[model samples]
Target: MNDTYKMMIVDDEFEIREGLNSFYWERFQFQVVGLAANGKQALDLMQRSDVDIVLTDIKMPIMDGIELSRAISVHYPHVKIVILSGYKEFSYARDALQAGVSEYLLKPVDLKHLGESMMKLKHLLDTERQSSQKLQSYENQLANSLPAARDHFFQSLLEDLLPEYHEAKEKMSLLEIEMNATYYCCAAVKIQWRDQPDGSLTDANKLAKATTIIERHLEASQCHSYTLKRKAGELAIFLNLNATTVSPRKSLSLLFDHIIVAIEGELGGRSIIGLGEVYQSLLSFPDSYKQARSIMERHIFRERSGLFQWDPADSLHMERKEYPYSVETKLLDAVLEGNSGNSTMYFQHFWDSCGLDSEHAELPLVLRYLTPLFTMLERRLDLHGASFETMANLHMPFTEYVEQFQTLSQLKIALDRLISDITLHIRKLNDVVQTTSHSAVQQVKKYIEEHSSEKITLNQMADLVYLNPSYFSIQFKKETGINFIDYLKYCRMEKAKELLRRIDLKVYEIGELVGYQDRKYFATTFKSYTKLTPLEYRQSFITY
Candidate 1:
C-alpha cells in the first residue's frame, strides 16, 4: 500500500466529513488534506491538491456522488473513490459502481470498516503506481508508429490465425511490435451511450473519429497496436502477450482513460469500458477478451456508465435472488402486530434463504439485497411518530455499517436489535386509542404519577380509564404524546430525582422507593435519563 497517499472527504454534512478527518486515517495510510461541503467543491479541491483517494457522500449538492464519480473515473482515472451514503442511495449502488467508486459505506460511518476499505485501496494504488513506474523505466528507443499491418497482425493473433510461437515472433518482428518485455496484458473499450444526441455522423464514423483521437494518446513505437473496426462491431479487441517489465496494461488503461473522456466529451455521450487481464500466450487471448466483454455486458445490463475491469480471480457472475413474498408478508404481519418473537423467527428463515448466512457472504451483495427491507421499515416507523434518534438506530446495520461481524450469527444479533425496537414501538401503539376522552387520559396520567413506584401495566391504566388496553394505548399517546409505559418511567425517574434533593435518603432507598429493587439498575436508568448517576446527581448540589 502507498504510505504517503493523500485523501479528501466530500459530504453535505459537516460532522460526517469532519468525523472522517478526525479518525486516524494516517494510520491507515491516508492523509486528509481538504474537506468539501459538496461534490462540486470536492472536484475543485481535487484539482489543486495532490490527493490519491476520495471519501465522498453520494447525495451532495450541485454534483452528486454518481456524477462526481463518473467525472473522476474519466478525468482522474487513477484516483480511487469510496462512496458514503445513507439508505436513500441504496438503489444507486450499481450506478455508483458504474461511476468507478471503489467502495460504498453506509452513513454513521464506522471507522473500522472505513479503515479496512482504505487499506485495500492503498494496495491497489501502490501496485498500479509501481507498475506504471516500471513501464516508464523501460525507455523506448523512439516513439514508433503502429501501422495497418500491426492491426491486421493483432486481428490474426486474436482469431488464432497465427501458426507457431516461432512464426509469431517472425510476425512481431515483421510488424515491429516485439518489445524487450516478457509479460502481456489486454484492455478493451466499448462505447454505447445512455443518451446520444442526434448527429449526422454514423456509428462507424463516430468510432473512427474516437479511434483517431485515441491514436494520438498511445505510444508510437515498440509494442502498441490500434485498429478501427467499422464492420460487425463497436470494439472487439484481443491482447495476447508475455508477462514482462513493459506494463502494457497500465499504458492501455491510461490510453483508455483518455479515450473515454474524449468520446464522452466529443462524441454522443457516456460509454462503458471493459479491460481484460494479461495472458502469456495466444491460447489465453480468447478467454481474456471474453472475460472482459462478459464483465462489460453485465455493466450494460446494470445500466451504469464507467470502466469495468476484469478480475481474473473471480469469473462467477452474481445471481439475482428475490425474497419470497410469502415469508416477506409473514414478517411484515409480525411487525404490525408487535410480535417481536415471531418477527425474528420469520426474518431468520428469510435471511437463511438469501444465502447470506453462509460463512462467506459478500457484504455488498447482501447489503444490496437487504436495502429494500430497511427502507420499508424506516418509512413505516416514520408514520408511527418515532423519534429521530430511534430512526438513526434503524439505519445503522443496513447501511455499510460496522464490519465487525465475521459470521452470520453475529450480524443477526445486530439485526435483532432493530427488529425488537420496531415491535416494541408497535406494541406501545397497540395498547392505546387516539379517540379516547381527554379526562380519561388525564386520570391515567395522575394514577401513573401516584403509583409510579409500583409495577405498572397498560391493563391497570385501561381499568382506570374504563377502556380496552389497545384503545387506551392509542388515546394516551394522542392526548399526551407518549405511551403509558414511557409516561410511567418518566414519573418514576422524576420522583427519584426529587428524592435526591433530600440528603438523608441513601441511593439504594431512593431506588426501592422508585419501584426498582436493584440499585445498580436504578443508577443506570437514572444516568440515561438525566445524564447523571444518583450519587453524582446528589453530589452536584449542596442539600440545604
Candidate 2:
C-alpha cells in the first residue's frame, strides 16, 4: 500500500459501502479511516483523524455530499475528494465540480479506474509537497548563509568563472539572478534628500520602489541589464553593456557609450560616473573597477556633471606612477617614533619628491600627487590601531577620503588637516609609549591572543595598552621569551591546529578564523607549523 494517501468513505447504502471497503482495500492500496453514513459523520471523523482523500455518496440522510464538498473546499483545500453517485445526475456532478471535487465516480464504481485515479492524485500530491518543502529549505539556507553567498559571488567574479557571454547568462540563471551583458562596470551613487521629505518617501519600501522604477525605465528604454545593491547609504550598480549581436569590438564600445549617457541622464546629473574599462573575463573586473573609481576620484575638481571613462581612448590619459618604497620606510619610522615634528617634515619632503610632471593640469595632477600620500598616511594610522571613533575624535577623515573633496586644493587642505590631527595623536601616543609598564606588556599579549584571527600590528597592540611601541617591545620579550610578532604568530598557529580537527568547516573558513588574512599565506604557514596541509591534518583526525 502506498503511504501517500489516506481515504475516507461516506455512503448511506450498506452494500455499496461494504463492497468498496472490502474489495478495494488491498488492490487500490488506500487505508480507510472509517466509513460514515452521512456528511456530518464524515466531517467529524476527518477532524479527529488524518485523511488525504475522501469518497462520499451524493444523497445522504443527515447532510448531502454537495454541502460536505463546500465545507472541505473551504477548510481543507489540500485534502482531495471524489463524489460517488447513482443515476446520471448532471446537477450533482456540476455542483461537486464547482466545489473543487477531485473526481466523480458512479455508484457501482469501476474499481480499476478508481485505482488509476488514486495513483495519479497520490503522485501529484507528493510532488507538490516535496516542491514546497524544497523551497522552504532553500529559504532557510539562504537566510543562514547570506554573507558566505556574497563572498562566493565576489570570489567567482574575481576568479574569472564568467568568461564567455553564454557562461555568464547560464551562471546567473542558476542562481535565480540576471545581469545586463558582459564588459561590466560599477558606479557609486550618493543620494541626499532635502529635509527628509515626508514619511511616505523616507521609508525603506519607498526607496526600494524608486530603485525599481529606475531599473525598469533604464532596461525598457535602453535594453540594458543591471543589478543594484545598496552599501553604506550609497547605491552601487554592477552594470553590463547592452547591444545586439554584431561586431564584437564595435558592439562593446557602442554599448558602453550608451550606458554612460543613459545612467547619467536618468540621475539628472546628480551623480558622477566612474567608467571602468572593458574586460573579456570577470576576474579582471576588480582591476578595471579600481581604475574607474580612481578616475572618478582624481578628477573631482572638474565640472560635477562631467563624465569620465577609464578607457584611455575616451579621454585624457595618465600613466600610473609608483612611489619609492624608501619614502614609505622613512615615514613609517618617524610615525612609530612618535616624533610628530619629524613626521610632518618627512611628509613635506615626500610631497616634493613626487615627480609627477603632467600636462592635463588641474584636479587630475593634484589628485595623482595626493593619492600615494593618502595611502601611506592611512597605513600609518591603521598600523597604530586607529578606529573610526579615533579619526572622528581627531576631527579629521583619513587623507584618502574622496567623498567630499571636489578639487586638488581641497584635497590638500583635507590632508593638511589630517596631518595636524595625526601629529597631535602621535604626541599623545609617544607620551604613553615612553612611560610603558610591565602590566601594560602583559595586557598587549592578552589582547593579541584574544584577537589572533584579526589583522594586528605591533603599534596597534601597544596602543591598546597605552604604551610606547619601542619600550613595549623590550618588556614583551622580557615577559614572553619571544618578540611580540613571533608570539602573535605562534598563538595563531596553535589556534589553527585546534581548528584543523573540525572536519565540517572548509580550509578557507578555518584560515580566516586564524590570524592570516591571505589564504595562500595561511596555507603555507599551516603546512610549515604542522608538516601537513590543512586537509591532510583534518583527514588524519577522522576516525570513523
In lDDT terms, which candidate is top? 1
In candidate 2, position 517 carries an lDDT of 38
**What tens digits encode model 2's per-residue C-alpha lDDT throughout 1-544?**
2444688988898987887788555445567878998998988887778788888888899899989998787656678898878857788788899998998878676778878877787777777778867755764564456445544665565443432222233334223233434455554443323233344444355445445654665555443444344443234445555444674345534544554454445432234445566544433455555666677666755544444666655545543433333464556456555567776777666655664333334555555556545554555555455532476453334333654666545655565566657667765765664445677876777787787666567667767886545546545766788766667768888888887775445687677666443465577667766889988888898663
Candidate 1, residues 40-59, lDDT tens digits: the string is 88878877777788888888
Query: Could you tell me how far off, in angstroms, the CA of residue 200 lies in candidate 1 after the best superposition?
Result: 3.1
- Model 1 CA deviation exceeding 4 Å by range: 1-152, 176-180, 193-198, 220-223, 228-233, 238-255, 280-284, 316-544
Which regions in candidate 2 have their CA more than 4 angstroms from the true location? Answer: 1-152, 155-173, 180-183, 190-210, 222-233, 245-269, 299-303, 313-544
Cα displacement (angstroms), candidate 1, residue 534, comes to 91
